[model samples]
Target: MMIKLLAIGKTDSTHLQELISEYEQRLKHYIKFELDIIPDIKNVKNLSEVQQKEKEGEAILKRLQPTDVLVLLDEHGKQHTSIEFSNYLQKKMNAGIKRMVIVIGGPYGFSEEIYQKAQGKLSLSKMTFSHQMVRLFIVEQIYRAFTILKNEPYHHQ
Candidate 1:
């Protein structure tokens, strides 16, 4: 199945972008992977946190297709081990899913509408990381999961 990562805003740090790209390139060997960045909202200084999330949510939802399996990277979501995540991905591929869309919400997190649309939520860790850093983490973990699935030497655990 194709795996897509949708996030709000660009990765501002050149170092982080390079790292994200490295993992993304590694992931291409295993699946059709793409990173979609939803540009940050304009004039957000006037909007409240909730309002910003609502606007971002609208943009996020617009990128989704009805058939795509939407998974949100939420702090309160289910946490999985590396091997377990690989199995979860395997199950989706086995089920013949066309695409698996994982979203990393804006700083204030997801809006209610986005929450309602999601099929599942996954947490990388209890500790919070910058939205940009989360992009790198998730991409690397995805690459690692595929390596684990294929019994490659990339993942040491």
Candidate 2:
């Protein structure tokens, strides 16, 4: 199954982008992985939080395929250990999923429409993180998950 990470805005930190790219490369050895960055909405100063999310949500929806399973990275979502996450992904692969679209929402979070479309939500941590940092964390965890699945010496119990 293909894993697609769709996020809003560009990563301003070159350091973070480099690290995320590293994991993206490593992930290719195990499964198809794509990091698609949606351009940030313009003139956000003029729009309300709801409007911003609606616009971002519209853009996000447009990128998804009819068969794609939508998963949102939400603060209030279910949090799983790295091992548990690997098992979760294993279940999806066994189920013959086509493409899993994981989304990182805008500053104000997702819109009602986006929430309605999502099949599941996952939380990396209870604490908040910058969107850019979250990108790296998710990518690395995915890479680590693959290593764990392969019995590689990357993750420790």
Q: Per-candidate TM vs. native?
A: 0.97, 0.99
- Candidate 1 shows a clash count of 0
The sequence of per-residue lDDT tens digits that candidate 2 reaches over residues 51-91 is 99999999999999999999999999999999999999999
Report the lDDT of model 2 for residue 104: 95
Candidate no. 1 TM-score: 0.97
Clashing residue pairs in candidate 2 (N, C-alpha, C atoms within 3 angstroms)? none
Candidate with the greatest lDDT versus the true structure: 2
Error of 2 at 61 (Å): 0.4
What's the residue-level lDDT of 77 in candidate 2? 90
Please provide, for model 1 over 1-157, each residue's C-alpha lDDT reduced to its tens digit, 9 standing for 90 to 100: 9999999999999999999999989898999999999999999999999999999999998999999999999999999999999999999999999999999999899999999999999999999899989999999999999999999998886
